[model samples]
Target: MKRKLSILLALVMILSLALPMMAGAETVSLAYKNGSLHLRKGPGTNYGSNGYVRDGDYITVLSKGSVWSKIETSAGRIGYIKNLYISGNGANYADGTSYFGGSYTGYVVTKYSGSSVNLRAGASTSTASMGQLRNGTKIKILGENGNWYLIETASGTQGYMSKTYIKSSAGSSSSSATQYATVTGSVVNVRAGAGTQYVVKTALTRGTTVKVLEKTTSNWWKIQWGSYTGYMSANYLRMK
Candidate 1:
């Protein structure tokens, strides 16, 4: 009876440790690619190609070895790809460890002004419009399909938006970034319009402080730089 009790206790301890390890497995995805990327059945090129992932193909990263990672596609296909090709919100780790830093995420910014991008039920423009994302509304990207990205607004609205009208950033910015910013880049150009097609007014050297006048609907900051008010790409400005 004593031996049986000891065996049972040992089994419970092993199960307890393994349970959390199994629970920690998480989802990750292949980063954006212009062309098709292949997923092999095993971790190396010697393995057979099992499937392919496109521009916004999201997958679950199962495990990471030294050079390759095992992943599962949305369609349930399992395969491996080079670790360098994988990108995701690092919130969860494949080895059942949690990332101490913030989880990986992406941002969505409007491309142009005067119009809102339709959030649809499907990737195509013809799909049902679930809602609209206004200019400069930052959203957390969840996944992608073709030229469309799956995103969720801060208000918890989720849908698809065309990639053409919205730009994707690697992570979120400080809440005050839209209100005030500092120039981080050397000689950043101040443009007449929100986009590069606009005329260049002048250039601001690094460390210049600018008042946050307005964030144009197209991701440009309309700023006041010592009375020379013009537009600059939001990318170069860091929130004060």
Candidate 2:
């Protein structure tokens, strides 16, 4: 009877220690004062835009890169958000685990005046205007173009607004290295070989960020990401 009791107590102690280890996993939240956010390809602003994320959204921090957090949206969309945008408001695990979040960091308009902006599909320029943006609204710019800018409105709408309407907001500057690289405006086919005649492996999702390893010519670039690497069209990749 004494041996059985000792065995039972030992098993209970082991389970207690194991339980906490399993419970250490957690989710994170996304919040900011400016109310606007950008989702990038790989956690830093250097990558191109995958989509726009708003304040109060919950994103799962899957992994951490130097200053960035690889997060997943409620819709299962995976992308990277700056550590400055995460609010780490939840309780920390007793196992010495913690996370991070950020206050609102502002963005700036990157172009001068008189730049033409194209309204994207599903965006209405008439009723869904870019927050009273006229030819010049002195707005906060999120991205740049040779002729336009991606801007955020006071009301949280993100669209291509003419750069001619806005100037750099106060305190909205970054290092030259932090400046965004232009992603190709067109979708390119992901192929199995380095030539156009190669077999089609798959169609890369629009807004996917790819690393250009080598430029075969003006039209093709050797690219790689994750476990897949091959030649893709230069017309599809933006310079970063």
Candidate 3:
């Protein structure tokens, strides 16, 4: 625990120091050919590769140099890439600004259920505030830069947020996350949506155990049965 705390503190301090240089950091896109461009811990191939950046991927150039450029990837990783691989071209948003794009899903995981996390214009804490997202809120993970994530809320609000406060799953794979229930009816139909109009995804036998993901409504609950995730009527499910 002490080691973890020390590491977290050290990382925060490092990011704090990097905030100024990243404040006005030039955002750019990668310009590599087929295959991925290696992101190294140092500026040269002599340095170890830490990650891969595809062609045209958005990156924030923290510090530019003649031969090498220190950058933060859209996935929140910091590394160095060759200067020749950096390009100024990218998709321009309606606001006339460049933003990263992604299709994965994630949820806000704050310290407390009532607490919220800040959204900013840039990855640094010193950036302009955009808004806040509350715990348990689902978001579209656009990309990550530094230790921050570029996310879009369900309401369409997009901005950068600390990556530490979000998770890829609805809950951790732990005993506490085991919200179990039993199929009450002899056989129950699990639909793709919350209503009968949706297609039946699968069928659950009587007394079959399932993991309840969310109680979408008093009548319908989203559940996980074996490998299937769909909605089942609450009337046919008895929470355990």
Candidate 4:
């Protein structure tokens, strides 16, 4: 009897430590635009509604099937949510700053400092924005910079934002390479071809951070990421 009791206590201690790590491993966030999302008892809509979830709710995504994701709610409620309604905005990469393989139902201001904040593009000041920001505001970071960031707000406002006001408790992977640039205050045209006069794919916003693949000339650097690519103003990128 004594030996059994001792063994039981030992098992309990091991489980206590392991449980917390496992619980923290598979976490995800709800999208800011998501409202009245149904939580099912299992990883399928056919399973039946376990409860209703709102925006800004933090949940743990345990596993995923084709269209449904099994999530553990904050209240210890386990259920499923459809993938279509969830925004996997930061779900593509595992880089410690992004939430990959999961859904974000709402925007949670991860960081908050003073009442004012400076928004940037691609996570740095090299990116331009419409203007400054305030506190308690939720924004989505499209990309990351060296301590700065590029973020989009709820009302379809896309621009640059500082990292000081945003925080994320989700798991992140290792960081990637550095892509820095300068601001020439010019509307650098992003082209599909690598020349001065190609079909203008899109116009780069002022202070946008771009990854420099190769410097085609003293004035142009081949860059691409997330959809846009082509020749941008060399003066705008800080090539080392």
Best by TM-score: 1
Candidate 1 lDDT over residue span 12-88, tens digit each: 99999776435534434322223356789888878899978654456677788987888877777889977655555
> lDDT for model 4, on a 0 to 1 scale?
0.53
* lDDT rank order: 3, 1, 4, 2
lDDT top scorer: 3
Number of clashing pairs per prediction, in order: 2, 12, 2, 27
Expressed as tens digits, the lDDT of each residue in 107-134 for candidate 2 is 4333555444443211123312322443
Clashing pairs in 1: 89-104, 90-104
Model 3, position 32, has a per-residue lDDT of 12
Every candidate's CA RMSD = 17.3, 16.5, 18.8, 18.2
Give stretches of model 3 more than 4 Å off. Answer: 1-101, 170-240
- Predicted structure 2: clash tally: 12
Any runs in candidate 1 off by more than 4 Å, and if so which?
A: 1-55, 58-71, 74-178
Better of 1 and 4 by TM-score: 1
TM-score against truth, every candidate:
0.33, 0.27, 0.32, 0.26
40: Cα error in model 3, Å = 43
Q: What is each predicted model's overall lDDT from 0 to 1?
A: 0.62, 0.50, 0.68, 0.53
**Candidate 2, superposed: residue stretches over 4 Å from native:** 1-34, 90-240
